[model samples]
Target chain A: MFNLFLKTMYDKRIFIIAWSIGLAFFAYLMLLFFPAFKDSGLDQLLATLPPELKALKGMIGDISALSTPSGYLAGQFFDIRMPMFISVFSVILAVGLSVKDEEEGYIRTLLALPLSRIKLLFGKLIAIVVICVATTIATVSGLYLGALSVNVNLDWTVVSNLSLVMLLLSICMTTLVYCIGLSTGKRGITMGLGILVGAGSFLLTTFAKSVDWLQPYEKVSLFHYFPAVDIVKNGISIWDVVVLVGITILSILLTIILFRRRDVR
Target chain B: MTIQPVLEVDAVTKYYGSFLAIQDIHFMISKGEVVGLVGLNGAGKTTIINLIMGFLRTSAGKIRLFGEPVLPENAHKMHPKVGFATGDMSLFTNLTGRQYFAFLKRAYKLKDDKKLGELCKQFNPDMDKKIKTLSRGNKQKIALISAFMSGPELVILDEPSSGLDPFMQQKFLELINHEGAKGTTIFMSSHYLKEVADVCSRVLFIRDGKLVKDVSRAELESSHGKAVHITTSRAIRPPAQSSLLGHQKTANGYEMSFIFKDSPIKLQQWLCSISYMLDFTIEDHDLESAFSDLYSKDKSEAKNV
Candidate 1:
């Protein structure tokens, strides 16, 4: 299982490293030259937004802390950097685990090896976890380095706790993708469903916030489970962490059940 | 003839939803024997391979290797001891042949790199290049090298000769024969009857997903891996003719066809001494021709039924 996990990481080693460095370098440059933009893309975007659009992104205008450099990194890291970077990360992990193998016909090859379907699923699961964990660490590390450069009184505890939160969220989201992959099995359909489920879940949560009746739908939104804003403003949300971690376990159970029953070919 | 089978597929059936992919196939492959599973396209050669590898579900039958039941979980345990290569199983494109072999080594837990190279070179593959960069035949050789690299006890190959050139096809045969010499059982499928005839000790013809022919070496040799058909241009007219009708003299005489048993030497000499230019064409028996004879009746009968 570890061997398969290492190989999968090797497949995306160039991407994880390259993407991490690229995001870090770009974030560092912003801290050095364009501090205002670096610190306030998400905050400024939120402030200028109409009520409906703000609800769509699950945002409320609260940016007094954006004046501080370290506080600014937290906002941009979660909203701007993570949305695009995490989407790309999930895409690569899903493709690596399911789509690429299905395309190459190596799924059948691996199946022919002395590994059970569950074992195979576990291997991909391990790889996906590593990718998600690495990505979250990279984002936190980038902003931490930027904070050091700017010489702000950085909140190490806040950073570490929030980083763990995002890592759990990433895991939950990616495991959801794995379950989708298992059910669909085909590359295009699995990926299309994964993105739709991830982004669509976010969209649903945003919409739920706009309505009083749809408030229950907010609980189902993966975004609803992790409170990035709460983390920056008032420390970690214990309920949010529980909900996110619960979703991760549920998604993994789903992966195991569906993958075990599905036709491998 | 007296030895036990290394692989046994007994009453094995596979269905994809409602469609029966393969039905109750019963066959046993002895050690060191190269068996050719001959079939046309969509004849379920690949399905049988999947069943044997436990990549598929058995509808009503059982696949046993070394006298143990083959289930999904157990398949992997059996797979390490069996090497399989097919046209569909692509080697990693970005990885070189050596790298892919190394992965297989790690996967199968092979320790000796020297033996891996020897197994690869035995199949005439260049290990330094990536698989995508290799030619079609060389890619196949690489696949074969990986499958055989573990020195598995049994090998299952599907349509190995399709992409290979004539020279490479010969090399493929030599490679299979070499593997067989080492007591590895070979279950391979090919369209080329001559190729199967060269090395296969037994020829199994699959028609409409059923094992129609469990032909022995003697039967294949006698039939030349085909059903010999003799067609004559002229008809065989009997000495005593019916006098009930006065018939007009047709330009051509009567003709007859028979299964030609012997070589053309006997038939050709017999034709040359005749006064008339009677045609005595000998048609070679092949999997295609034999299969046509075997199942061509299904079309008309199915319509009536």
Candidate 2:
């Protein structure tokens, strides 16, 4: 299991490094523009907007808090941007590890080794978690350094809490994709369903605020548990963490069970 | 003391959805035996190999390796004692051959690289080049080396000589012979009849998801009988004999050929009964002719059914 883990990590080293650098740079760029938005009288502009346009604010956060450091960062980055980017990354990673490998017959080489299917999958899961944690740290570091450069007094604890939630959310997305990939062993299905779930969850949660019919079902969407604006203002919520962690664990168990029952290529 | 077979496939059946890939396939290989599985494409050779390797589970029945049942959960425990290589086996494309070997070495928990070095020297693969950059034959060399490097007790190969040149194929056969001499029971699937005849002590013929025949080399040679060619003086009706197989007439009904499985005395009596017989010759039957005869008979049987 350790050997498989080490090999997976080594194989994905370049991928992890590239995502970390890219996400960090993106976060830095977003922070660089935060000061401009704060000084541009955007609050008054947002307040004067029509109600129909105002309803779209659910996708980001409270329009009134757009001028504050925590709210601006949450609304612009953590709320939608970070989750979208991480989800995309998670889908690709999961598909590559499962469906792509099987389709290309590379999984046969690994299976021929003296390791059980469960160990092989667990090794890959650990590697995915490590990559997600590394990228999250890079994003947080970029945010902290960007804030320092702009002389913004930011609370590091709340930011870390938000980062933790982001990490869990990304892991949840990855495990879901991994489960689908291993279950179907089809690249198209895995990617399509992975993107749908990630994007669908975010859309459902966002529209739930304005669309009364979607409110009760909002909890079904993974993004509903990830209230980025609330996390930035009020620190982490244990219930949200529990929900994400529960989904991740369930996805992992389902992945193992399905993968074990199927025929490998 | 009775010795246990190295591999035992007991009435194993596999189905892909509703399609029966292999049904009630049964075979066994003892130690120091080199067995070959011969079949046409989609003949369930690979399916049986996958089942034996525990990459696919048996729908009905069981497969055991080294006296333990081969289940996906416990298959890995037997993997250290088994080496598997397939023609289409994919390697880590980004890694050099050397790196791939290093990973395998770690996975197998080998004490030293001695066996790997020996295999590299024998196969002469370019260890410094990435696998993706290598040719098909070169990649196959890497696979063969990896399978043999661990010095497994039982090696299973599926079309192991697919991309190999004749020279490399000869080298591979020599390796199989050498390993077999060391009491390593080897089971391989191949389309190359000559290769099977050269190295395998026993050959199993699979056709349409069933084990059609299993014969040892000595039994195959003795039981297949002789190829007979006879020239007649006139266009007379050919003698009706149940032992005659694949009978064909040419040269305006003067020349006739068939496989004679009956005794030599019976052949002589039948030949003597034909007064217009001009000339005749009988020779030992070859495996190629035997294989074709078996498949052709099967095709006719299927058509009849």
Q: What is the TM-score of chain B alone in each candidate?
A: 0.79, 0.86
- Residue B109 CA error for candidate 1 (Å)? 1.5
Reference-based TM-score of each model: 0.84, 0.92
Top-TM-score candidate index: 2
Chain A TM-score vs. truth, each candidate: 0.81, 0.93
Chain A TM value for model 2: 0.93
Deviating ranges (above 4 Å) for candidate 2: A45-53, B223-226, B229-243, B246-257, B260-273, B276-285, B297-305
* Quality class of the docking in candidate 1, CAPRI style: acceptable
In the range A95-143, model 2's lDDT, one tens digit per residue, is: 9898988988877778888988888888888888888899999998888
Best by DockQ: 2
Candidate 2 structure, TM-score to reference: 0.92
Of candidate 1 chain B, the 10-residue stretch with the lowest lDDT total is B238-247
Measured as a fraction from 0 to 1, the native contacts recovered by model 2 come to 0.75
User: Which consecutive 10 residues in model 2 chain B have the weakest lDDT in total?
Assistant: B296-305
